[model samples]
Target: MDGHRCPGEDVTVSVLATVARFLARSAYEIPEKDLRIPLERITTAPPSGFVVSGFAVPPADRSAEDQHPA
Candidate 1:
């Protein structure tokens, strides 16, 4: 019952674990200097929440306070 086969069972924990494993693998492959997860990120609502599986970020919503602040 490995991570690859866990998705077939449709178990929530297993699915989450598989996702974590995939993220871990990605972290391992990518250089640390290139990785960035903002410490200020908040997932309570839109614009800052996670995106997945071809869900596009709408063009009008801006997460930060300013787009081109000086």
Candidate 2:
């Protein structure tokens, strides 16, 4: 057998590869690679006042202490 999911085969990477190939040919394009999200980013907070995406530096104040560049 060509390692296909005939009936009760587990849905492992092998089966996915075969299906992906078929879809790519049918769609007239190579299958797009999986874009894995960065796991470390998931637990972290996003930037302030910039919508929820990733951490960002807070806006600087006009005080003397804030005058120092990081």
Candidate 3:
């Protein structure tokens, strides 16, 4: 290891990009609620974990390979 770069960094970035793309195209609604994170907690997070509803996956976003499996 010549530098601090991780061997799986490229794979990690690719996976994250794929996930972001999927989420961007997907349709969903997050209910209105107090999403404030309390500073007192060590692991900061919303009091009630993020809640999503009315999710609808668009057929047009699916790739041809996904629509027809080998």
Q: Comparing candidate 2 with candidate 3, which one achieves the higher lDDT?
A: 3
Kindly report which residue stretches of model 2 are placed more than 4 angstroms away from their true locations once superposed: 1-11, 28-70
Q: What TM-score does candidate 1 reach?
A: 0.28
lDDT of each: 0.48, 0.47, 0.87
List of clashing residue pairs for candidate 2: 47-54
Worst 10 residues of 2 by lDDT: 49-58
Worst 10-residue lDDT window for candidate 3 reads: 56-65
Clashes of 2: 1
**Per-model TM values vs. the true structure:** 0.28, 0.23, 0.73
User: How do all the candidates rank in terms of lDDT, highest first?
Assistant: 3, 1, 2
Residue 8 in candidate 2 has what lDDT? 48
| C-alpha positional error of residue 48 in candidate 1 after TM-score superposition, expressed in Å | 3.4
Please give, for residues 18-60, the per-residue lDDT of candidate 3 as tens digits: 8888788889999999999999988999999999898877677
Candidate ranking under TM-score, highest first, comes to: 3, 1, 2
Q: Give candidate 2's whole-model lDDT.
A: 0.47
The most accurate candidate by lDDT is 3
